[model samples]
Every structure is written in C-alpha cells, then in structure tokens.
Target: MDKKSPSDTAEFNISAYDQAEFNDLLFENMPDYAFVKNDSFKIVKANSAFLSMYPTNIRDKVIGYTTVEDYQPKEAELFLARDKEAFEQGYSETVETITFPDHRIRTLLTRKKRFEAIDGRTYILGIATDVTEREELIEKLRKSNDDLDQFAYMASHDLKAPLTAIAKLVSWIDEDHRSELPVGAIENFELIKSRINRMTQLLNDMLTYSRVNQTPHEKEEFSFKDLVLEQFDMICIDKEFNLSCCELIVSLQKDAIAIVLRNLLANAIKHHHLDHGNIDVTIEEKKGFYLIKVTDDGPGIDPQYSSKIFEMFQTLKPRDQQEGSGIGLAICKKIANHYAGDITLIDQPNGTSFLVTWPSVPTQQPPFKRIK
Candidate 1:
C-alpha cells in the first residue's frame, strides 16, 4: 500500500479539529460556571468561568483538589452530599447561595449529572447559573405588595369608625327633629343617611379586597346548595328573588367560593329591572376545572363593558345609580386566577351569564352529603 501523503493526514483531522476547537471555545467563554469531578470527588476540570470565581491565590490549586477546604464545613458537607446523589441517582439539581472570592454573594441554580467519557472513567458534570438579581427583584416586589395590603387594611379600619359615628348622628337628628322639620329637610336627611351607608359598604369591601389573598385557600367539603342559600339569605333580606341551583357536594376553598357566589348573586339582584328575577347557578367538573355558570334574567352587560367589569373599582353604571364598590368581581377574578382559573362573560340575547372556571384538585377528604 502507498504511504499516506501529508495532505491526506490534514484532511482526516480537519473535522475532529473543528469539533474540539468549538467545544473548547464554548466551555471557556460561557457565562455559567461549569466543572467536572471524578468519582473520588476531586475537581479534575473547570471552565474559565469557574476559575474566575475563586481568589487568585487558590485558582491554580483548584484543579486536582476538593473545594471542601475552601468552603465552610456545612457547605462542604452539602456539596459532597449533592455529588454523591448525582453519582448514585444519575442527576441532581438545587438552588444555592454562595459568596465569591470578591465577597459578592450570588444565588445560583446548580445542576449536576453523571457523565461517562470515552476514557471509561465516571465523572460528574456541573453547571451553575446565577439568579441573584432575579431573586432580589422577586423579594422587593413581595415586600411592596405586603406594604400596600397593610396600608389598605389600616386605612379602611380607621375610616369606618368615623363613618359609623356620622351615620348615628344623622339618625339621631332625624328622630329628634322629624316633627319640627319640613318634609324637604326630612328627605335631605334620608339622602345623607343613604350616602353614609354607601360609604360604609365601600369601605367594608375595600378591606375585604385587601385581605382576599392573605390567607391560604384550603379545600373544604360542604353542600354547594347550602352555601348559596346562606349567602343569598344574607343579601336578599326583603327582595323577591328566585335562585335555582344544582344540588351537588363540592370540595373547594369554602370562604373563597362564598365570595364568588355572593358577588354574582348580589350583581344579579341589584341590577334586575323588576322586584323579582330568576337566577340560576350550576357547576360541573370539567377535566381539571370546575365550570360554574351563573345566569340571571337581568339586563345583560353590554359587550363593551364586559371586559371592564372584572377590573378593580370598574363599574359600567355610576356609583350613585348603582351602589357598589366595584371590587366584587375583581375579588372573584383574583381568587380564580390564583388557582389558574378565570371568569368570563358569555354573551346572551337577553340575560347575563358569568362563566367562572375554578381549578379542581383531588378531594383530600370524603365527599360531603348534600342537604335536602
């Protein structure tokens, strides 16, 4: 056979050379810290990103050594345990906060997996992505929301006491001067009382909205019919309204569900053109969600206003014409979205229909019995 020429040798090595060069450039230039450790847990290889993280004095000794001596005892133990888990289980992942040689702290999403090289030796490949800025942003946003909720709660509570006193004063004046005052004066006082009551209701709703998501919504077993009737009775004291609902037992967050039902029922009754109207509520389990349909024979919401109804303090009609804080549907939407569900308006020819999708979870307890 003829000896291979120099050109043939270069051509044979071209593909391998390109591949090796690409991998080397990627490992050295990548932003995330990357390292490889042997079964003995000694770091045998590390990228430029990893070496730059250590102090200048220790950088040269990092290879062929364990980092336990450079880290705290507890941190060393944790790192060793993670390495063992990766080797045994094939992979491991965790979020850890570490301080760099420059004294800068960083939160990292660390991933480690067992990788077997052509040398027939077992090794662990590790990668750590810095998430320090993301974590700080999340913490700041959480604190801001908590402060806003607290402010709303305190303001509403403080204002209610003075409002209550004003209402009482108006009541006393009417009782004491009704006989001596003109009919117009009596009407004026009545209007003042109504306004005071409206303000009080608005404040109460604001307080409820602020605390809507403060508590965890734990699932509970209860009669769906009973819950509807209970909330309806509270709102419809003297009003003539017919509520037809399905008789089903449901397992869900009881208080959160109550708020949804109460708001829907109140909207129907309050917006009805007549003294008596028909309201129907039915719920069915749909795969991963509970589909709740609340339909009422009242003036349906205009298509234009449908989108605005669920927003906080958004109402189609003026507050004077319709007495509401406009936070009812907002509360419902917030609670629904928290569970990865939604509330939507289904357009109908005459009546309004609210479709509330509540995410369903496996019942943790026995089924509740429906009351007759």
Candidate 2:
C-alpha cells in the first residue's frame, strides 16, 4: 500500500466531508426554526418546526417565496433593516421577535451565513436559537437589582435618624455631666463617646457605599496622574510614611477615580505592620486594561481570611487594633465593580498587595446611571 502525498491528502480530506454520514445527523438534531434564504432574501428552505409555527395557508404560500417584510411586524422594520445589512455584509446573527399566525409571538435569534451551493446558487443559511427563557431571566435579575437598590436607600435613610440622635445625646452628656461625673463614670462617658463615633463613621461609610451606585457620575476626561499626586500629597502631609515612588499617570473620571485610589491608599497606610513601613503604588497599561497595584510592606494577611477582606463589615482585626470602620475595602470593591473592574489580594511571603484591574474606559455606562 502507498501512502498519500500532502496534495493528495488535502484533496481526499475535502472529498471525505461529502461521504461523511452527516446529513442524517443534520436533520436528526435540527433547530426549531432552521432556515435558508437566497440573495433576494426569499425563503428557500425551512425546517419542520418553522412550518408548524405558521398557518397552513400562510405556510404553503410562504414556502419557497416570501420577503422579510411580508411576515415581520411594521414596528420591527428597524430589526429587518439590520438583518438585511447583516445579509449584505456577508452574514450576521440577529435576534428578532416573529408573530405566528396564532397571534403568539416568538423570539428567533437567527444567525445568517453567506454560502454558495454546488449549483452556484448564493444563499444565506440561518439557524435560530430560542432565547425567550434567557430574556425572561435577565428581566427578573434586573427587577431584583432595582429592588435591592430601593432597599439600600430606605435602610440607609432610616438608619441615619437614630444615629444622629445618639451623636447628639453623647455631646449633651459630655457638656452637662463632666463636672459632676464620678471617677469611673467619666470613663463610661468616654466609652459612650467612642461608641457614638464608631456608629457615626459606620453610617457615613454605609451611606457612601449605597450612594455610589445611586449617584450619577460626571466623567469628564482628566489626568489620573494629577488625581494620584493630589491624594499622595494629602496622605504624605497628614501621615509620616515612606511613599517616595510617586509615578504620575493619566486616567479619566477625576472624582470617581479619586474615590477608588483614596480607599486603597488609606488601607495601605492604616494597616502598616512596621512603624516606618513602605507603600508602593504602580500603574501599568496592558491590552486595554489599567493595572493599578497598591503594595504595603506590612504584616501580610492570613491565607484563610484574604477572601473576606472586601466583604462589607468584615475585618480581620478588632476596632481597637486598626480603629477601622471596616467599610473602606468594601467601598473600594464597589467602585471597582462600577467600572466593571475587580480587586484581589495577593499574599506574599513578605507582605500583602492589593491589586485592582479596571478598564481604561468603561465599555458601557454603569447600569445604575439611568435610574432616578
């Protein structure tokens, strides 16, 4: 037996497709509304499911003869135009709602491909997948988000009233009872004062978190370098730390971007392990993604609890140890998610680094922008 040459093998492989038992496989597992149309956009072939969807009269008349306009609703002209454009552009997949003769509507996401038959006939092969269930699920998720936003608004607003009263009472007790207070009584007062302070801080942070999604953004193009520099200056002046690596890089959205960087820097400095710790900030551009990393030479996080750091109200250390509201990282996570970005903590043998990856420019406006 002689082995086939490269050229001969190529020809034989092409012919092998014709003899392959695929025709039975094709019709056996055919889609519900599988169809083909000629260059004129006339129906050339439709599967059994397509025929079952229409009345006998319309089906018979429509077979081998019908334009998109003949069956599509008038309001759906734009959709048909898009399909036609896809057909002209050498093929496209379109999801359109078609009204059956029974007056029931069905969504058909038809993928059109330009192909030439053996007889040199140009046709558009369209395969449709039913997406009604997926669309319904999406709508349900949308409604769930709307409900969640409303609950957050209500919950935050309701919490502020009681918080304000507690703060006011704390101030009143400090002013009126300081002179008459016993030795240990003043310490109790201080405890109340500290509790009120923590409550106030927690509420304010919660309000900010809830409002991030609810608030509309003014995304004018601004330099990210300027934003980081301004934040670095403020942090340096306030706290004594070794943050020498001040690399200036340009980024968009002045205030929103500022919010993200502020929380990250705050966390770095607040959680420093050493008296004079190191904080390194790096900005890298990679394949349409902005990679911003904030590294601290502090005591690294435990491997077990690294995942829970960004969760709301989750803290590894007690309030006395870090004196944190525990909402900073949660807010950072929210801001990152607003721009379709993500935040992760990488635990090294030496220290911990918080890595944030955000798009240079968001692909779409944050979904909450449209809601009032």
Candidate 3:
C-alpha cells in the first residue's frame, strides 16, 4: 500500500453523509420529543424520541400522516391550529395536556418554529418537553404544606382549652390553700403560673403565624396615620412612647396589613431598653413599592442576628428574659412574602430601623376561596 503523507491526513474532510448521520444521532438521543411537519401539519420527519409516543410496532405508520389521522379529532384540531399559528406568526409555544397513543396523559411544554430547510422547503420544527412529573410533584408539595398548616392550626386551637383549665385549677389551688402552703410551695405555684402564661402565648402566636396568609381579606382604602392609630389602640403600650406616622393613603388587604403593623409595633414596644422611647413610622412611595420605615430610639438588634430573627422560633434574647414566642417576625415575613414584598432591618447608628417594602399592588392574589 502507498504511504499517505501527513498533509493528506490533515486534509481529511467530513462528507455530507457523515454530517447527516451526526444530526440523526443527536435528534434520536435528545430527551425531548422532536419532529418536523410540513405546512399542511403532516409529520414528514420524526426522531426516535417522538416515535416513542406510539407503540413500537406502529411507530413506522406515524410518518407522512397528520395529527388528525393519529389522534382524536378535537386534540388534532387544537394541534393543527397551533401549528398553523406557528407558521403564520413565526413561532408558537404552549404548555398543554396531551394524551398519547399509549393512553398515558402528560403535561408538555411544546414549542414550534417555522424554518426553511436546505431544499428551500418551509417546515415547522416542533419540540416537546414532558413536565407531567414535575407538575405532579409540585402539587403534592402544596398539598403537604396545606395539610401541615391545618394540623398546626388544629393542634394549637385544641391546646388552648386544656391550658386554660390548668391555669384556672392552679389559681384555685393557690387561693384555697394560701395560708396552708409553705413559702417554697407558693413560689413554685407562681413559677407554674408563669410557665402556663408562656404556654398560652406560644399557642396564640403559633395559631396567628399559621393563619397569617391562609384566608383572604377584602382590600380597603385607608390612611397610614389612621391605620397606625387603630393598631395602637389595640396594642395599648404602657410606656409613654411617641408614635409618629406619615400621611399616606393606600389600598390594601386591611386585616393582613394590620397584622404586620401590629406585630412590628408591639415588637418595638416590647423590646425597648428604655423607660420611654420614640417610635416613628414614615412611608414613601417608590417606583413599584411603598417603603415603610419604622424607626425606634431603643436598643437596636445585633446585625449578626438580623437574618436569623425572621425564622420561626428564633429569638435574639432568651425567652425568659424577653417574653416572646419568637413567631412575631416570622409572621411578618410570611405576610410580606405573601404580597410579594419583604421586611428588612436597615442598618442605623442609633436604635433599630426596620424597612418594609410593600408592593403598590399585590403580585399574587391570595389562594383562599372568595366568599360570594
């Protein structure tokens, strides 16, 4: 055999035959369904992935046939219309539920684009990605979350009755045996009462947190000043603290917003490290959201714990030192997220400043069923 020079090896070229083989390999190996259709919606070419939708024995019959011949008339008509739209509009995409020849239903994200082949023939190249399993998993996760919330709500509600009865019984025992009990016994009874009170608070906070965004409330127009004043009446801070708010009117879910404001204001008052301090609320209309800043002249929160404070059952100070169930900020965060907003602690030199970003309009409507 004649020896081939190095130059001859370097000049080796891939023929059209090799290129076609490579393209076929890629199309067949792809994980998504791939097909080519003529202007009339006839399946002219289909990859193995697309053929897999039909039985192996009848796969060969799929080519050169329109969807109307292979699928139900209603389903075929919808697909034909989508294909025609793609050719007319240049492209079309949709997420649709499809029933295959195997009788299995699937959710598919499909895209069809009009393109001209090398032979100058216009064709619709279609690709479909199966997303049925993903959607099913998402639905399962949502149901699991709903079940967990129901369990938490019911558990907390049921606990309150027993807790109240125990508290009453303890009070009765203390009153009935006041002189007969020893000093240590009296102190123990007081501790028991304190623990009972804490338990009650915990259950109440749990119920509130679980129910934060579960139910929908009607949106109402109200002024910032009036809303804060209304919450203040309910909170009733004992210390002489200044409450200042800007005059801004907003239309929002009134009851939900009230929960957020009430929790934040109560936190400021409860955690104040002074006999009397100042609490100021200012609102500014931003481009897409309203900035509500609540500034207090009390000791500020540690920056290291800023992110942690928003988590459920997280508290900077010991529960004994600070009487809290630690669900206040978590509830606030949930309510904010429900409206596609957020709450963050703004870094300030003196005292803590919490910046609340509330969207001008809710990004997503609450999932609760509307009352007729």
Report lDDT (Cα) of residue 76, candidate 3. 72
Winner on TM-score between 2 and 3 is 2
Question: Per-candidate TM vs. native?
Answer: 0.84, 0.80, 0.79
**Candidate 1, residue 55: lDDT:** 89
Q: After superposition, how far is residue 216 of candidate 1 from its true place, in Å?
A: 1.8
The best candidate by lDDT is 1
Which model scores highest in TM-score? 1
* Candidate 2 lDDT for residue 341: 82
Model 3 Cα displacement at 285 (Å)?
1.7
lDDT of 2 by residue, 1-372 (tens): 988789987765544567554653574367657777776767777777766667666677666775444455663475456557656776676666777655677776666677788989778766676777877788899999878767776787788798789878877887987788797988987887787778777877877887776666666665566666678777755567766444545555557777878887777777776556778877787887778888878788887887798999988888866677788888888888887788988877877788888887667753222111
The RMSD of every model to the true structure, in order and in angstroms, is: 8.8, 6.1, 7.7
Candidate 3: list runs displaced more than 4 Å: 1-30, 36-41, 68-94, 103-105, 111-126, 362-372
Error of 2 at 38 (Å): 3.2
Report lDDT per candidate.
Answer: 0.87, 0.73, 0.86
Clashes of each: 0, 2, 0
Q: What is the per-residue lDDT of model 3 for residues 1-372, given as tens digits with 9 covering 90 to 100?
A: 989998898665668898789888888899999999998778998988889899778887789987566676777778888899889987887777888987788988788889988899899989888999987898899999899889989999999999999999999998898999999999999999999999999999999888878798777888888998889767855677888888888877778888889988898888999767888988899887888888898899888888999999898889889989999999999998888889999887889899899888657654332222
lDDT of model 3, residue 66:
75
Model 1: per-residue Cα lDDT over 108-168, one tens digit each? 8778889899999999989888989988998999999899989999999999999999999
